[model samples]
Target chain A: MKEIVKDIRRWQKQDKKIALARVIDLDGSGPRLPGAAMAVTEEGEVAGSVSGGCVEGAVVLEALEVIKNNERHIVSFGYSDEEAFSVGLTCGGTVHLFIEPLDW
Target chain B: MNRKPQKDISIFDRVEELLNEEESFALVTVVKGPPVGEKMIVFPDEKSGVGFEGSLGNSDLDRVVSRDARGELTAGRSGVRNYGESGEAREETVQVFVESFIQPPQLLIVGAVDFTAALVKIGKVLGYRITVCDAREIFATTQRFPLADEVIVEWPNKLIEKIGQTFGPRDAVCILTHDAKFDVPAIVSALATDVGYIGVMGSRKTHEDRINRLYEVGVDDEGMTRLRSPIGLDIGSRTPEETAISIVAEMIALRTGRSSIALSETKGPIHD
Candidate 1:
């Protein structure tokens, strides 16, 4: 979230609706950690990231719903682990993200 | 549960303020309980109950969750925790996300050389608040180290006296000044603090000679044990940029208490 502070504050100043998606848990080896976060504006502007580019698209959609419905959700993206055994596999990792409107 | 929010200070604004000011705090949010999305801010330095702002829709739940948030903050961890709605144990009626926002560790580079510039860049990339210090004003300017959080023109001992109070296990002191007159005083002052990694740049022979001088100045074997005389790991790095990567990698390995060996040599799970 610190990486997207300027964007968050910018959206806030511009009065743009925004949602936050944070990686709350990890089931296996992954590039990002639990505290990794991504912020999305209502119109699809994004800052930061929740994973190594795999689940971010899905998280953006989820964040859009969070902003539209004004509801919080724990959305898990479970990736296939078989291919991850190969060396230099960057995307096959599982992450649980908490998506919520920045209402508070 | 009926408490009012602070005047003109939303929890998000407070969060940004705390982060910018580098204050250690935790943000707690109820993700799977009544009044979901409700949030609270917890400052671990404050007393229980008094430390919290905002509510989790119940007084008892707020009390319990805020207390646990402090524990999570101290650990510098962020995760979801289960709890009963009324704060009872061994129940999962409520799920609270405790997100810790600890201050970044300080990286004190007691040199103003080309390696210092490289280190400042890499240290910032590793999320360290870097400070480059040297008595040479010509070299210690911000123009030379634009990435450094602070560029101080002072002797190592004098600078340490001013900022050493906050140096702790998470902090690191890298003495890139290979000169004996500069590196020796830097090492001594760094030893005075509890800064975790003390990497002094020198060759094996120079390190041996420096050790003799240190022994002469009363740095015992215990103190000598704390020093990583040749600085970074044996990665055979030749350039300043490569040396910076090796140095920060050494810092990470030291902080995690890992052996700094390749994963292929070990048999355990790669993640751990």
Candidate 2:
């Protein structure tokens, strides 16, 4: 969040609807920690990252849904739940992310 | 929900303002249960009791979340916590995410030498608030260390005395001044603080001589162990830029208690 605060403010000034995704929890060897964040604009622009390129594309898709529906919820990705989700972390670690619209 | 025209500033505006000011705070948001997306900002306040702004639906939940948020802020951690509606303890009806925004750790380099310039650049890349201090005003000028956050023209010991209390496990003090007159007092003063890493740069001969001087100044065996004389790892770094990398690498290894060896040679967890 600190690293992308400038980008977030810039998009806000341009009146671009944005969605924020933050890694709220992680287990095992993860590339990023809990506070890792990523912000995606409604125009498909991205700033910051919540993972090591493994789950960011999925997170962007989730952010687009969050922006459209204005919903706040959690999304988990990892090899542990490979049966539940197609995308999983290559490092075999679980990461839980909360995606929400930037309206608040 | 319908798209509404933007007219009023939201809580995010306040978040950006606080972040730009480099103030430490926490953002608590309800991610699960009723009233999802509700938020409250918690920070230290002189007037208000808990320094809470905004709400998480109700006052009871606000009070409970604010208290836990303060704890998370102090530890510089962020995660989701479970709670019952209206702040009950036994139930997991509500889940709130507590995101803490902490100030960056500090690095004090007590020598405005050639290596200081390289060090400041590397420290900035590592997200540390770098400060270069030296007794010589000309050497400690900002022009010499443009990357440093602050350049203090003061005696190393005097500067340490002023800001030593703020040093903690995440902070570091590097005594790059080889002169005993400056480095000795700087080392002694740094040892008195809780600063995690104290690295003094010098040769083997200089380290031996400095040990005698340190013993004369009452630095016991325990205090001697805290000092990383002949600073930096044995990376065969001859250039200042490479030496700076070695020094910062040593600092990270010290904090993480790693052996500073090749990861392939080790057989344990790579990260904690």
Best candidate, DockQ-wise?
A: 2
Off by over 4 Å in 1: A12-15, A79-93, B1-5, B47-50, B262-267
Which candidate comes out best when scored by lDDT?
2
Query: Candidate 2 chain B, which ten residues in sequence have the lowest lDDT sum?
Result: B1-10
Across B73-186, the per-residue lDDT of candidate 2 in tens digits comes to: 888888888889898887789999899988888999999999889999999999999999999987889998988999999999998999999999999999998999999999
What local lDDT does model 1 show for residue A83? 49
Q: What CAPRI grade goes to candidate 1?
A: medium
Alpha carbon lDDT of each predicted model: 0.86, 0.89
**Scoring only chain A, what TM-score does candidate 1 earn?**
0.86
Which pairs of residues collide in model 2?
A: none
**Candidate 2, residue B56: how far the Cα is off, in Å:** 0.5
Query: Where is model 2 more than 4 Å wrong at Cα?
Result: A80-85, B1-9, B44-50
Question: Model 1: per-residue lDDT, tens digit, B1-272?
Answer: 22346878878888888888999989888778676788888887663335778888889998888889989999899888999989988999898888899999999999899999999999998899999999999999999998899999999878987889899999999999889999887788889999999999988999999999999899999999999888999898999999999999999999988888998888765565
